[model samples]
Target: MTEPQHILVLGGGEDQLPAYHEARRLGYRVIGVDRRPDALGAAASDLFLCMTTRAPDRIAAMVGHLDVAAVISPASDAAQESVAELSRLLGTPYQPAPDAVRASVDKGWFHTVLDRLGLPGYAYAQSSDEAELRRAAADLPLPVIVKPSDSSGSKGVQVVADPAALPGALAEARRHSFTGEVIVEEMLLGRHLSAEAFLRGSTLATIAVTERSTTGAPHMITTAHTVPAELTPSTEIRLRSMIMDICGELGHTDGPVNFDFVVDAADEIRFIEMGARLGGNGMPLLVRHAFGINTYEAALRLALGQPTELTPRHHRKTALRILTADTDGVLLGVDGTDAVRALPETVELQLFAEPGSRVHRYTQAGHKLGYLLLVADTHDALRAAQARAESLLRFRIEPATPRAASAAAPRSEELTEQIR
Candidate 1:
């Protein structure tokens, strides 16, 4: 009898859970590692290693100790490098070159490479100084976007409509960035869509396109995502072609890839960014529900150099709506969760915070209180279920206590001088 393959899943964010589940479902002995001892995915793995994913030696040692057949990371920038480094140490064929992964991690380099390839997309400039930022703001069109070159989940991203706000936006960008470099780009107006793909060597397989709904103002965090992007067949075909070409250029042979884009009023597709991992917010689960394809399984299979099954078994509508708190304070309570869970289309309701947990003001996706997954036969049904879920949701938070203002005390020297 042959021994079962062992797979190592790095980190345990909401996005990494599906990979762990699918690997186990496929009969692979899975191990999950994270810096946090209480990470969610740790509960589901065969072995849980609480350690730093950035430590390549530790990871390599763990992989060897467990005899892991493959190392996989989902929706993590740091883990991507860790996987590459571990693969190099283990003599595995599963990872892209470190330089190629670096190009994807650094937004400035990604844009430069795409531009050099004459890819169809918006123009972008990287600024590390105030003068350069001001110049870029002057040259770029109004309603431009400023964000950190290496950040994800929409952090440090601001849409500036006026030149006067550029300085403050630049400061905010620098505040969230470790590299001290920000990217300024021309804002393209269009319907946002995400296409997920799996690659094997030079061959590419398109999974499904999802329509994304994001917060419009102060934040660009994704609020909802619906599968089977509401696009005509021709547009979907074009978007898939673009994704395949981009992945090929990036040398992404195996594993999951998500490409985000905007469909302009002219029906043209503009590339935004691509992550070399699974989509977050239960997107992988939603895709499985809609298409009868398991992206998580495909990714593990590819990483193990095994054959993958890429056929879609069904066509349905599925959506994930993130529950966000409207205010910042200690979470007093969450109401109507049981009622929401009773809905027919409600697949899962997950809350990240406890009653006494301190919940900050919702700014980015990271601040979301929880998420609701819904599946239905049609887009209207899915939207209706999401609405019902929202109606049943309630968050009670205490108002934040304001800091006391310091009282100004008169100085004795100033008073004596005035008297003199």
Candidate 2:
């Protein structure tokens, strides 16, 4: 029998499970590496290595001798960096340069590239010191948005409407940053749209523009995302053009690329952040459920140097809304999960916290405890399903003291078990 080829998948978290399973579907043995022993993706893989994907050198020590075919990370920055490093060592088809990934992770770099491309410009500053960050916020136009320079999943993001709020906001942003650096920029106001783009060596195969909602000011936590975002034909064409230009400039030679952009009231499109991998919060599942296509499988096929198809068989709609904790408390019970799951339009309903888990305020995407994922055949049907979700999903909380709050430990806000 021929030896089964091995594919190294970094980040053994729930969001990365699809990549592991997809690689297997393509006849490759999946090897996973993550910092946690109980990572959800590990169960889906043929072998699991308990190691941090952030340290590529360490991961290389374990899989260095393995005859790996390729490396891929679905929803993590650290893991993507490791994939680049491992790909270079293995001589496999992967983004071997850290700079390719930095085009998305480093906001300062992203802005510089945007200026080079003659796109919309936002004045920004970067620094690690809280004093410098506050000064940058003050120096930039008032109502600046401050966020970690190299973090994802809307983690450590804060919009300061007043100068007085800049200091605290800077602290929160710093908490989620691995490099202890933050980007302070002038706020871009308007509808934020999530860009779902799949590419293979600079070839844009498929793209989806989704309408996104977020909690305004203080902390910019995403509230909901709806696929098939209604846009004028001209606007959609322009969006696609811009996304193609971005992927080319970013040197996306292969695999999946995800981005979050905003269309200001002026109808100008500006991408704020991006990732060189599949997105979190069940975005791949949304694409599959909404369009009868699996981007996860597409990404795997690209990694293995196989021909892939991304044509949408049908137009389907997807809507995902997050339910967050208003205050610090213990989760008592989530009522009507069964009823919501029973709904014909309900694609997935996940409650992250158990009956007694301590839940914290929703400052970032990781702080969200549950989400209602729905899919419908039509826009009206999507709205109806959304309404049913809103009414049927209720969170019962064991309220905590007004002054008391759950102490948050430092964690990678991306690819956590709380994610899909």
Candidate 3:
């Protein structure tokens, strides 16, 4: 009899939880590692290893101890790096080399490669100094975007209209960037969508496409994602082809990759950015619900050198809407969860923050308090249900006073610098 496969999953965020469940459902031995002892995914895995994903030596030691058949990270860059390093040490099949992963993580390198390949995209400049950024702002067109070269969850992305505010925006971007390098580029105005693809060797298999709804201005964090994106068949084909070309150019193979793009009013698709792992915050769930394809299972199979059955079993529309507070304050309570749960078509409702926990001004994806997942027979129906669910939900926070607000303002910047 063949031995059961053992897979090591890095990090214990909600994104990695589904992979852990899927691995167990497939009868694979699962080991999860996270720095926080209270990480939710850790509770669901066969073995929970408490450690940071960036500790390469420690991760390597764990992989050796487990004799893991394969190592993978579902939706985190740190986990992706760990997977690459562990794979190299264990002589296992990972997605790419450390250098390739680095190229993907660093936004500056990613844009440079896209430009060199003559891909349809805008130019970008990376700078750490205030003077360099001011110069770059002067050179670029108005309404350019500023963001960290290596960060996720739309943490430091900002669309600046005036050059006078460039310095403050640059400082904000730098606060979220570990490398202290920020990229300023021409902002593409269009409909935002995300595409996921599974690669086996040189073959790229396109997954479902979804329309991404993000909080406009002040916060560009993704708020909602709906599958079977209201795109015509031809447009969908064109976007998928472009994404496959990007994957080929990047030499990404044998795992899941997500690409975000902007479809302008002219129907032209422009690149935004791409991640080497699965999309976060219930994206994999939507993919499975819409097409009956399990991204988590496929990722594990590919890492183990096994063939994946990339067949669609059903066609249904699904959506996930994040619940965010409008202001910063202490979270008093969450009401209407039970009401939302009683509603039809509401598949899941989860809250990430606890009572008494402080909630900050909505800045990025991480600031979201929770989310609701829904499904329906049609896209319109799904959207309607989502609207209803959101209406029934509420997050109550104690309003801050003037003196308290002043004290809280510094906390935001401090937290931002820590995450960087």
Candidate 4:
């Protein structure tokens, strides 16, 4: 009897569970990796390794003896470079090179690439030193955005509308950065949008743009995303073309690429960042629901060096409502979940927090409590369903006192169980 070929999966979180399930369904042995032992996806895999996916060489060295055929880091930006490196080491056919992955993750490097390609130029500066960051921010216009150079899920992001808040924002950004580096950019004001697309040979096979809603101001965390974003035909076409051009220039014209962009007041596409991997926050689910295609399976096939099709069978309006808290507290309970789930348009509902789990203010994507997925026959229907669901779902939290808050800070493992 022949041994089953091992497929290395870099993350074993809830968001990464689909990839693991897909790999197993495709008759491949899954080797899941994560730093936490209690990862939800770990139980789903044939084998699980308690280790960080961020270190490529280390992972390769540890798992080299296994019959690993292909490697993938689904729904994670932090582990992408490792996926590329492991692919190279294992002789897999992952399209992105290590340098390209690094460029995609490193905001500073990607901004430079945009400038070199003569794309839309947004004034930005980056540095690890406080003095240098301050000096750079001084040159840019006020009301800038400050964030870690290489972090995701909107972690440590701050909008500095006031000059007095710049220092505090910088400190917050630096605190989240693994390298202590931060990027400050002049705020691009307009409709915040995101796209999920798959590329095959410099051409996009499938794409979907979403209208993004965020918690306003200081910490702009995503709250909801509605697919088939309300846009004129010309605007949609231009945005698609712009994304294609940017992907081609970045040398990420081969697999799944998720993008964050803004359609500014001048109707210009302000490209924010791109990830050479599947997007988190139920992006694949949204794509699947709206486009009648499975990007997760497409991404899996890409990792396996197999051809995958992305032709949409049908189109439908879909919306995702991210569940969040209004204030920092321990989750006492969530009411009306049954009522919300009973709605006709409610397709899926997930609750990440238990009664006693600590939940925080909606400051970043990582702070999400849960999400509601809805589908409808028309735009109006979708909007109505979204509103109805929001009103139906109520979160009861016991607000933490100042001293208790510091002492009872939620551990990463706990949050990983609840949020990620």
Candidate 5:
């Protein structure tokens, strides 16, 4: 009797559960990796490895003996390179170019590729030295964004509207930079949108344009995403064209790719960034619920060098709202969750924080306590359902002590001086 092929999946978080579930459904023996032993996907995996997914060499060395047929890192930017590396070492057909994977995560290199392709891009400067960063920020106009060249989920990202605040922002960016590099660019003012697509050669087989909402300025964490983003037919065409151009130029013309861009009042699109894998924050799940096509399964099939079916089974209105707390405190309870789940429009309700755990204000995507997915027959109904869900769901947090608050306040103010 023939044995089932082994499929290695990086990340075992809530967002990565779909890949693990789909892989199991496809009859592959799943091996899951994550630093957290209690990761949500661990229960779903056939074999779970407790380790960071960022180090490809360590993982490759550890699992090299297995007859791994394919490897995938769903919804994780940090694990894309590792996935590519393992695929190459294991001679899996899903090997994406290592350079392309690096470019997908590096802010400066991504913009450089866009410029080389004559694609729409913003004026940006990158450097590792603090003096150089200040000079770069000076050249740009007021209200610029400073961020680490290699970090995602808005970590160490800051908007500096004043010259006096440049140093502090630079320090934060540098602190988060895995490569100690920072990019300073003008803050493009416009409607933020995210595009999720699967590419076959140069063609976008399945695509979704989503209206992205973020907590405005400074920390700028994503708050919500509404699928089938309202766009003019012409604008949507241009956006699709741009996606092909960017992915094609980077030599990443296959598998899943998601992009972040801003469409200005003049209807001009400025590229922010792109990830060469399934998007994090339950994007694949949302897409599945809204379009009736599962990109997670498609990605797995693609990894195994098999043909995929990405045609939309149905088109429906859907949205995802990130759940977060309002202040730093101990989680006491979550109220009305049962009522919210009973709503007809509620597709899924996931809570990440348990009672007695620590929760913080929503400063970045990482700070989110959970997310709510909703779907309805019409856009208006979807919006109404979302409003209703928000009203019914509540996070109860016990306020932090005065001493603890005092101790945490100086961490930001003192970081600049210490980093200097």
Candidate 6:
């Protein structure tokens, strides 16, 4: 008899739930970590602890006495470097160099890398203080975006339409930044897309292209994401070529990478940002439903020192449409959750808020109250599933504390400052 292989998963949160679930499907022993005690992923883990997944040194100490097989984190940017650091210490196959992971976490380092690679990116200036930031913004193009250099989930992102709005936007962006630094960039307008791919020891596996739609502005909470993003063959090939160049430059090995881009009216693809992990917002999950391939599981296999399966098993149209509250209130309940779940088109449904739970309009991914995963054989069927979701599933909210209601309202890209 063989002892089960123990895998150290770096994050244990709702956003990381799929990783834990996939580990179980593969029958691997999973040890999960996070900062909170009540995290949903923690509950699903075989062993759970309250610890910051960002501390690589501390994590290394935790596994000091154990013969851990490999360390990996799926759908996590904050855990990327930690995983790399620990795996390097352990001499594992899933190792991505610490320098590359660090650059991914620090916007300043990321910008420098992109410039060196001659990747098409935005003109930007970095500032550490209000006085310096204000002075820097004064000269940049109008309607520039202000955001934390070291944060995720659009936490303190804001748009400054005019010079007068720069001060407030800077304050918000600074608040979310752990380093107290922010970046201001030239705002470009166009369609938002994400390139989902894998890097296996320098070889690129261009898997899926995703269409990203977010609330117009002011926190830019993602509203809907369509998998296998509809793209002309020429456009897809161009995007994949650009992605291969990026991965080649970054030196990504044995893991997934997600990149967001904006294609302007001129058809030029400008880089929005890059995340060196499985994409959040139900992306890896949607890929599994539509293509019958689980990238998250592939990450685990890579950690286990095995080859991955990237071939498409089925061709289906899929969408992950998230619903947010319109106003601040207590959730009464979703009307047809069971019905939505029963529908054949419904692949998965997750409701974050329960009856009497406080809910409100979107500020970030956390503010979303519920989500519906849909799958169909045709694009038209996919649209019908989304439409049925909107009609049958409803959020019942009555007035509560208006704090959430007072969040920044949505604005158009032209009307607000957009950033990478």
The residue pairs that clash in candidate 4, if any, are none
Q: Each model's C-alpha lDDT?
A: 0.76, 0.77, 0.77, 0.83, 0.84, 0.75
Which window of 10 residues has the lowest lDDT sum in candidate 5? 411-420
Which tens-of-lDDT digit does each residue in 208-285 have in candidate 6? 777888886666667888877777777777787877777777776657887778877667777767777887777787
Candidate 2 overall lDDT versus native: 0.77
- Colliding pairs, model 5: none
Off by over 4 Å in 2: 96-98, 129-131, 327-332, 351-358, 399-420
lDDT of 4: 0.83
TM-score of each: 0.87, 0.89, 0.88, 0.92, 0.92, 0.89
Of the two candidates 5 and 6, the one with more favorable TM-score, higher being better, is 5
Give the lowest summed-lDDT range of ten residues in model 2: 411-420
Candidate 4 per-residue C-alpha lDDT over 1-420 given as tens digits, one digit per residue, 9 for 90 to 100: 776798899988767888998888888999999988977767888888888998888888877887887898877888887888788888887657554597668998888877877778798989999888889888988889999999988999999988889999999999999889999998999999999888898898998899998887888888889999988788888878877767766777688888888888778877888888888888898988888899888898988889997999889899988888877888878878899999989888988778997888787887778878999998899989888888777787766767645656655333222221
Cand. 3 TM to true fold: 0.88
| Clash count in backbone of candidate 5 | 0
Per-residue accuracy of model 2 over 21-118 as CA lDDT, tens digit each = 88888888999887778677667888898778887777777777777888888878656666777887777864444656887568878888888889
Q: Candidate 3: which pairs clash?
A: none
By descending TM-score, how would the candidates be arranged? 5, 4, 6, 2, 3, 1
| Best of the two (1, 2) by TM-score | 2
Consecutive 10-residue window with the lowest summed lDDT within model 4: 411-420
Which number leads on lDDT?
5
Model 1 regions lying over 4 Å from their true place: 1-6, 25-31, 42-51, 61-64, 97-100, 399-420
